[model samples]
Target: MSFPSFLSHRLSLVQEQQLELAVLAEHVKRGSGHMRRLALECLAQRQAELAADLAQVAQLAAPRAALRKEVAA
Candidate 1:
């Protein structure tokens, strides 16, 4: 199956954000003072973005999934 270019781009962005969140989590664990605080804030923002992207991906894929089910029936 092929995805629209925009969907592919969004998926890649989501993957990148997930990786960044992992790194930020590590920074939060080992960092201290202002740096740790900054990392925590960034983590929160990235988490929100990831949630939004996941929702968009789900919305885009829903129709394709339904079509597949209809074809199978």
Candidate 2:
């Protein structure tokens, strides 16, 4: 996909993850022992996924950014 489209897709994924985390946070607050544990686990997993997504974006962006700098120079 083109960079714009690729960024859009990633943005959506980030937004969805954010929403999921919000819901999970509520569950953690109100849930009992087992339920809270499950919510916390899901939250941790989601956070890791988000971190990976961000890292991938940065990795992809670095090359394009360097190309832009070369063009400008």
Candidate 3:
């Protein structure tokens, strides 16, 4: 083939490969975004459960404070 045709052929191949790469990259980005959102939701739920447990512990300790003070005196 002529030099011009050869260059055009090569450019076309390169363009095809680049398009495929762009599609793959987009899919990866979408998957990563979805996974990150899922992880964040799980973490938020766990944090809320931990907060509730801590609050319950605090409430139970409140009534014991008077006994502690009497013992200290």
Candidate 4:
């Protein structure tokens, strides 16, 4: 599933997550031109611990997102 969709599945508050997802979506929408793409890539390739970690970054940047991007950075 898509990243945002994945988040939506896990999070209860769809509206709030949507807002944050919208913004992050914009960050990712730039066709790999945006610097934040690095963050997205990190999310994509990472497994287990590192993957969860990057996911947390995205969650934190937005409003009440889920999985609370782990802080062990």
Candidate 5:
């Protein structure tokens, strides 16, 4: 149960990061000034990095969950 809960939390983090990146991308498209676009792009990149980290955490959590299930059986 804990492993499933942890995976769910990590997945939610990934979803949140992706949503932020989408918002940043919209700002990059609509930004009036060069600096604004540049800043938005940087933020989008950081969000992508965070999402990737969350994905890795999810992958790690998957095996733990499988092990726990097998142990219970």
Candidate 6:
């Protein structure tokens, strides 16, 4: 084969490889975006649960404050 034909064949092979790489990159980006969204949702749910627990703790402590004040007087 001539040098020109050899280079042309190699160029076509490189192009095909580049196309495959682009497709793989896109797939990874989409998967990462989906995972990020799921993580954020899980974080929000955990925050809500913590807030509820804090509120319950505060409610339980309220009655104790009055009793302590009465004892101090």
**TM-score winner:** 1
**What tens-digit string does per-residue lDDT give for candidate 3 at 1-73?**
9744755565565556555545555555566677756655655565565556556545655667767899999
Any residue pairs clashing in model 1, and if so which? none
* Candidate 5 runs further than 4 Å off: 62-73
Measured against the true structure, the TM-scores of the candidates, in listed sequence, are 0.86, 0.85, 0.51, 0.29, 0.63, 0.54
C-alpha lDDT values of all predictions = 0.93, 0.90, 0.59, 0.54, 0.78, 0.59
lDDT for model 6 comes to 0.59
Global local distance difference test of model 4? 0.54
Of 1 and 5, the candidate ranking higher by lDDT:
1
Least accurate stretch of 10 residues (summed lDDT) in model 3?
A: 20-29
Superposed Cα deviation of residue 3, candidate 6 (Å)? 88
The TM-score of candidate 2 is 0.85
Model 1 bad stretches (over 4 Å): 1-5
List runs of model 4 lying over 4 Å from the truth.
Answer: 1-12, 31-34, 39-73
Ordered by lDDT, highest first, the candidates read: 1, 2, 5, 6, 3, 4
Q: Which is better, 1 or 5, measured by TM-score?
A: 1
- Put down candidate 6 lDDT per residue, 38-66, tens digits, no spaces: 65565556556555655654565567777
Runs of candidate 6 exceeding 4 Å displacement: 1-32
lDDT of 1 by residue, 1-73 (tens): 4587878888889999999999999999999999999999999998998999899999998998899999999
Query: Judged by lDDT relative to the true structure, which candidate is superior, 1 or 3?
Result: 1
Query: Across residues 1-73, which tens digit of lDDT does each residue of candidate 5 receive?
Result: 6866867787887778777777777777777798677867788677769967876996788788889899999
Off by over 4 Å in 3: 1-31
* Ranking of candidates on TM-score, top first: 1, 2, 5, 6, 3, 4
Residue pairs with colliding backbones in model 5 are none
Give the Cα error of residue 73 in candidate 6, in Å.
1.5
